[model samples]
Target: MSSPHPRLSARQPRYMIVAQALMHDIETGRHGVGSLLPTEAELGQQFNVSRHTVREAIRRLTDLGLVSAQAGVGTRVRAQRPVNHYALTAEGLSDLFRYAHEVALRIDSQEEIVADGALAAFLECPPGQKWLRLQGERFVRNEGESIGLAEIHVAASYRAALEDTNRPDAAIYALIERRFGVEVREVRQEISALALTAAQAKRLGVAPGSPGLRLVRKYYSSSGELFEVASNIHPADRFSYASTLRLRPTGESEN
Candidate 1:
C-alpha cells in the first residue's frame, strides 16, 4: 500500500502561514465582518508563534482590506472580500496572461538601454545586457483611475516585435509571440508590499510613501529561456490578488 503522506515543498514564512489561516477563518464565517479578532497575544499563543508574526499577519489582512487595525482598539473585520474590483481577476496563475485584453497597458515610452547596477539586479540579468524597456500605466477599460505603473523589459533582440505591433496597448508577451513566434510557457511571480516612490505615487494618484503592492514577474519561453521581466506597482487600495484552492481527496497524489 502507498503511504498517505504527500510530498511538500519548502515551508512558507510564519507570518504568511498565520495570515492564510486567519483569512480562511474570515472567509468561512468564523470571523464575520464587523467582528473583532482576538488579541495579537492570544493569536500568537493559539498559532504558537511570536506576537510579531501575528502582527505581520494582521498587517497582511489589513492590506487586503479584510481588517482594520488601530491603537488600543483591536483589529476589526472590515470586509469579507478585497476592496478593489479589477477588470481582470487573476484567479489562477495562468489568468495573468489574459490581463492584456482585460486591463490594457497604455505605453508611455519605449527605449533601448544597457542594464547595470540596480536595474540588472532587478531583472536578474548581467550588467551591460541590452534591453528594450517599455514604461506604461495599466488602466481598466472605461475607467478613469490608472490602476498600475508597469516597467517591462524585453531582450534587445525582441525590440522589433514590439515596434511592429499596431496595438501599443497589447501585452508584451503576446506581441512577441505574434511577431517573433516566442511562446511564454511559464511565469514566475513575486508579490510584496512597499512604500511607493514619488513618481509611482503620482502616477497612481496617491501620496508619496503610501503603501503599494509590488509585483515582479519573469516570463520564460518554451525552451526554458527567460524572455521578459516586468515590475508593476499598484496602490494597495487599488489592486488585490486572489486565487481559489481546493482540498485534495484521500489517497490522491498531487500532480
Candidate 2:
C-alpha cells in the first residue's frame, strides 16, 4: 500500500518544505494578510504531518516576520514578504545570509585607494595594500529611510566583483566567490560602541554625537587570505544585535 502522506524529499528538512509551501501560499494571497491560518490540527491533517511538524513550520514563518501567534488567537498572516529590519539574532554564517537578503546597500561613491596606516589597522591588513572602496547607505529594500552608513573595501584582485554591486539582490562576498572562483571560509566580526560623526549622522538622518554601533566584518578565503572588509555604522535606535547561548551536553568538551 502507498503511504497516506505525500512523499517528502530527503534533500531538505521536512519542516522547511512545509514552511516554503505555506510561505508561497501567503505570498500568493491564498492566505491573505491578517487572515488566521488553520489550526495546528487542521494544518497537520492537510499536510498529513504531525502537529509538532506543523508547529515547527509555523515557527519558521514567524521568524521571517510573515506571521504571529498569540495564546488565544490562531496564527495570522502578517506580510506577503519578509519584513526588513536591522535587528539581527545571528547564530552562524547562515543568519548573515538571511540578514543580507532582508536589507540592501545603495552605493553613493566608489574609489581605488592604497591603505594608509590607519586604514590598514582598520582593515586588519598591511599598509599600502590597494583596495576598491565602496561607500553607501544601508536600507530596508524599497524603503526610503537609511539605517546605517556602510564602507566596503575589496582587495584589488577581486575588483571585478564590483560589476554587480548595483544589483540590490546580490551579496558582496557571494559576488566575489562567483567572479573569482574562491570560497569565503571564515568571517571575523567585531562590534563596538561609537558616536555618530557629523557626516555619518547626516547620511543616516541621525543627529551627530548620538550613540551608535560600529560593526566590522572581514571575509577570508579558505587559504586564510583576506578578501574584503565591510564596516557599518548604525544609529542606536536603528540597529540591534542579539545572540543565543546554549550549554554543552554532558561529556562534551570545549574546542
Candidate 3:
C-alpha cells in the first residue's frame, strides 16, 4: 500500500514550497489578477508554515512580477498568468541566455540590410556594414501573452548559419557555432528603461507610452570580433529579472 503523504526531502526549502503553492493558487484562478491575496498571517495558517516562510514566499512572488506588496496594503496580484521568473546565480553572467530557455521566442521575420545612419551607430557597426536581422516575440509557456519583443542582428558573415535552421527560437547561437565552427568568448549586456513605441507596443500587446525594459547584448569571438547584437523589450508588468551576487573577500582577484 502507498502512503498518503511521502516523506519530504530535507534539502527542500520551506519557502520555495510555500511559494509554489501560492503560485498555483494564482494560476488556477484561486487568486485572480489584480485581486488582493490573503494576509501573511492567513497564508501562514493556511500553509501551516511560519510567517517568515510565508514572507519569503511572498518575496519570491514579488520577484517573479506576479504580485506587489505595499506597506499598509496587502499583496496584490499584478499579472494574470504565471510570471516567467529567472534565477541568475553568481556562476554565470549570461543571465538573459538563461531566460531564453524558459520562454518561447517565435521569429516573425528575417531580413538582410546594410546598416547606416542612426541604425549603424546604435548597433556599433561601421557604415554600410551588412547585417541579418531576426525579429520575434517572446511568449511564456501555457500563458497566451506576448511578453516581449526581440530583435537579433547577426554580422553578415554568419548570416548563412541562421538560414540553415528553421527553429531560430530554440538555439541560434548554438547553430552559429556548429555552422561557423566559432565560439563566443564574451557577452556584453546593457539594460535600460524605455517607453514603448506604437509599433513595439502593438507587437508586444502593451499600450503606447507604457514603460518597458530594454536589454541590449553583444556577442563577441575570441579575437574580439563582434558576431551578433540583440535587443529585447519586455513589458514592465510581465517580466522581472533577478540575479544573485556573491561577495568576495578583499584582495581576491576576479577570475
Superposed on all Cα atoms, the candidates' RMSDs to the truth, in angstroms, are 13.1, 10.6, 5.7
Name the 10 consecutive residues with the lowest summed lDDT in model 3. Answer: 1-10
lDDT of 1: 0.80
For candidate 3, give the lDDT of residue 40.
Answer: 88
Candidate with better TM-score, 1 vs 3: 3
Q: Give the per-residue lDDT digits (tens) of candidate 1, residues 1-255.
A: 111113222387888778877877787778898899999889988888899999999999987878989899999997776555463467665688776677767778888999999988877789999998888887777765678988889999888888644336567888889889998888998899999999878777667998888888899999987779988888877777776678889999986
Residue 28's lDDT in candidate 2? 76
Best by TM-score: 3
lDDT of 2 by residue, 134-198 (tens): 99888877787777888999999888878745644577888888888889888888899999889
Pairs of residues at least 3 apart in sequence or in different chains that clash in candidate 2: none
Q: What's the lDDT for residue 226 in model 2? A: 88
- Candidate 3 TM-score, true structure as reference: 0.68
Off by over 4 Å in 2: 1-85, 164-167, 250-255
Report backbone clashes per prediction. 0, 0, 0
Q: Name the better of 1 and 2 by TM-score.
A: 2
